[model samples]
Target chain A: MAADRVTLSDVAREAGVSLATASRAINGSADRSVRPELVERVTAAAARLRYSPDATAQAMARGRTTTLGLLVHDIADPYFSAIAAAVVASAETAGLQVSLATTQNDPAREVQLVDLMRRQRARAVVIAGGRSAGSSTEDLAGQLAALRAQGVGVAAIGQPVPGVPSVAVDNLGGSASLARALLALGYRTFALLTGPRQRTTAQERCRGFSDALGAGGGVVIARSETPFTWEGGHAGMLRLIDDGSLHGVDAVVATNDVMALGALAAARERGLRVPEDVALTGFGGISTLRDVVPALTTVAVPMGELGERAVRLALTAEGDVVESVGCDVVVRASTPDLRRR
Target chain B: MAADRVTLSDVAREAGVSLATASRAINGSADRSVRPELVERVTAAAARLRYSPDATAQAMARGRTTTLGLLVHDIADPYFSAIAAAVVASAETAGLQVSLATTQNDPAREVQLVDLMRRQRARAVVIAGGRSAGSSTEDLAGQLAALRAQGVGVAAIGQPVPGVPSVAVDNLGGSASLARALLALGYRTFALLTGPRQRTTAQERCRGFSDALGAGGGVVIARSETPFTWEGGHAGMLRLIDDGSLHGVDAVVATNDVMALGALAAARERGLRVPEDVALTGFGGISTLRDVVPALTTVAVPMGELGERAVRLALTAEGDVVESVGCDVVVRASTPDLRRR
Candidate 1:
């Protein structure tokens, strides 16, 4: 028995009870048809045996584990945090618990987490992502298919994968509006700091900015690409300055708030005045920028709403599912005043 | 059968296999003298019969579930988010999965999550605080104790619970140094926007700030306590201004970055010059703040490391473990230049 796995039957045998009764005792069920002493016996037996209940079997017998898995690329960003919060709130409302896992933009981790969620027999899995520089998400697609084949519901945030419910901000529309905001403010020179190019969100944002500013009678633009992070923004802005590429650029737009914050810092270090000598803005309206100096003028996506929507869809998906959401722009002091670019 | 809770034995009977053989097949143990086709048969039957392995039973049989539950109050906060990222990284290294839930500082939610996590048969559970205004956590102390009695390793962030391992920041030391920084700069009057007074971290911060200022000679201190959030900070700062008390304060020390950002806006709205009229400093060196205008000088906490540590303790703990770790302060611009102030 020491060399072999100790199963539930062993515990039941030791406690002189049926397997179900043993389960009831370990689960702390209040009303079993057994004596209190029997409950105590089962409990002692379980403790002695060190039982870790089979999640799958319990889920099958108990109707559900009342648990869901949340998959994200990273959790440190306010954007994901916002969505994660919503997912938790919505899952609780539906009587299901959600657990969050960050993939760190690694598709291998993505596949591992999805598979683990399946093995744990989670009621549902909500997968969210940002940009990934390495590994193709084609495997995520396969995992989605496998889980669906096994009757597990799946939800996606960011890009809508086939056969999964999705919630996403309108990366293009938000980026376009931000670019238009900058253009209408009369800023001619523009610097861009985008997320990993492969990420659909970053790609859409870049496209939106280009269309809004480079279309028809648009102004001169100088652009550079940087990862969607504060460090990237800081370094990208510095690179632009060192290269003298920012000499004529009057405005800088980052794909996300972290990068924008970085750009703002870079500007400050160089003695550049924001919204006066240089206007700075970004996409995601993370909280840090909400109250910063010359509060960032950017788009605020309903991240919590996205997380909530994803969970609701995963819980209630009738069949193969797909959905999308958009974002709204918040104007603040960081953008150049309309009267002066 | 539909009304009779679906059982693994039912699947075994339907698949015409012995219980042991069925267990081996369903668990995907390929080396147990079972043909691949037979293994496939068992799994297919499980899916068809909706057999969920009992989570509690499975735990007893297996030493691991590859599932971990992370409990927190707010995922949107950068500190918590950082910790979450760290937890994910560590969990990946251990070949485990993470499940996250937010209590929103609500004690009832906290109770609900703990119960759900137990049912899900998580190997470890990590609880971070939620702002509980109505329901007292005094009731939760019992629930947590019961979980401990169940033999599940639990870890926490912020403050330690009895017999549970927790990761805590050096709130007193960090706040003390921040206050002293401004005091050394000869700032006599201070407006302090603090976090929820009920939280242990916030209490320590208050004590530290008071102690620092007291050592430098008594100074007039105007303070307001609010929940840690952007709106709370903004409203708290506004209150100081409307009360005509802000003029008497030369600097503001907020307990968190979000609140500090709010204070910055309040200062701007009140036409008070930053660093010129009232130097502002905040706790939590968030990535988003790196972009704020004039930047914020504050203490940076390794939120990610905290998350990782909490998870590690929970995963590796043996019996009745309690642990604490110190936090380093990250200096930012929110604290004014000592010479200038």
Candidate 2:
């Protein structure tokens, strides 16, 4: 295929230039000599021949660039930010460079950004937050398979991107722990604030919360599905309070910190004292949560560690890849007394 | 300067081939009729001449590729996260794409990243938390100057890069506002906690804080500088408490959220109740702080907006261009409280 494709020689022949001269014209070497007329002809020839210089081919022939690419949904999210920091720190230790990219969780933008990373000659790629390019898991599977064939490393955070190594907190385990904590506080009725039902992290956390709390068949009478944004949490909590169900429910466990924080605000506006009147718990112990009043009693996933591990996994050889690791629980003062205040 | 370089015609002449055939040999786009021997000759001639394709040349002839490069210091910092989010959203809105590359305040990495971004043909470049390459501002300046010469749109955030356009907050005003707020509440003595003196934002904020309060007859006594990180703030606060001079100060002004949070923690350890005892205020109203007890009195910087603006400015031509905007002060219960606790 390389032989048949229009090579630099073809452009040289078409422009009636020496091989070295053609290379210089194409590369724009500073010290080389060239006539304006010859430069124009060489350019025209290059275009006519559809020459690309093939960045991928260059990588293969010249060894690796020792760079990897990382794309995420929202870097502002403490979860992603924590992971990113960890990843960069780790990458530095490994003598590898990371190229970071972000998608606002827009699917089209996700595909476009990933494509560009591939072109950058990245030997490995990490996708955090959003789903892959395909509409179906199978499609995502195919994308992974394609990357495998090309010898590119791929890993993801959040939902395991088809065949990629993924690192996550045992959402189910952690949520169960949180639920048990709230349950012990003698909270019968519960208000569940959830995230987008699609993402795996949200779903698993919800399941964990339910499994531990409802395991004994207590009560989880109220719930709302909102975006995993701070606003969503704020709005969701307000809605729970407005429904008057918050009065009946003794506890609130948001899928993430933002929602949990929002729930706290809503309870406050409703004249409820946290832990006294209504115990509130959030997941994802981000730095922001550390300063929250009655510091969040939540799960602290090693976000930065996840990022670094994800990168290492992607860079690992194809067949020898390890699976995933679990995160830990971080309990603060958010849930003090369990009963209604 | 562009015209004096070697041309493709020179290669064809040396290879004894027609211009089109030489072009084919060089670019690897040749029909079955093109002989392998001719291609060899073309490649040999090109190699002998040491050809290098002009990156800018290829870009001009080709339509813009769908990629943007973003550089920042620490993504884990809520400030950078907000900016990164804004940039990604803005880039998505513009139908342009972005790839992230973090410098982590390392000058060598910064230079390497810039080179990588240039090689990737990023449509524009945004550098947040940039520093001197090799920890020397001179080296960092030299690289930025080189990129400018190549016509790369350069925009920075948090601090000015001499000739670069920077999207930064009114740190001076914001700090002054916080100080002014405390003064209004009758807190006379203060111990300020600041980030590294090298950080532009940190320096600007310290200046603002001191200018506003220090000029008030040294009422703000002294300040300690720490890393622009949480632990730094924590350690600084501890130092103040152990030094026994804290009794002379009734309030503390921290430069940023992480440090402010550390201060809050330090205060709690010292059994100081917020507002009623030692009033506290933090700059950069980050997430989770809203959930903290006494809700940090802070300046809610437009972090996302800063990021979006930085991306836009990076896309524009460089010159004496400047954009500065005001931030909002969030009055929580941390400052000198007038309300009876």
| Index of the highest-lDDT prediction | 1
Docking class of 1: acceptable
Taking chain A of model 1 alone, its TM-score versus the true chain A equals 0.82
lDDT of 1 at A321: 62
Which TM-score does chain B of candidate 1 obtain?
0.81
* DockQ of all predictions against the true structure, Cα-based: 0.33, 0.21
Which of the numbered candidates is closest to the native, going by highest TM-score?
1
Q: Write the per-residue lDDT of candidate 2 for residues A1-341, one digit (tens) a residue.
A: 21244677888998899987787677655355678888899999889887655332233333344457778777777788888888777766675556666766776666666655544445677777745333744555565555555566888776666566665457788888777766676666788888887866788888988988788566788888988887888888888777777767767778988788777776777777777667777887776776666677778767766787787788774563445556466656767654544
Worst 10 residues of 2 chain B by lDDT: B54-63
Per-candidate count of clashing residue pairs (backbone under 3 Å): 43, 69
Docking class of 2: incorrect
> What TM-score would chain B receive for each of the candidates shown?
0.81, 0.77
Q: What is the C-alpha lDDT profile of model 1 across B94-195, one tens digit per residue?
A: 766677777777777788778766655567788875333333565565666666666666787777665566666777888888767777766777878878
All candidates: CA RMSD in angstroms?
6.5, 10.5
For candidate 1, lDDT tens digit of each residue in A22-136? 8766654434455788889887887788765655455555544556788877787778888888888788788776767777777787897787676666678889876343345
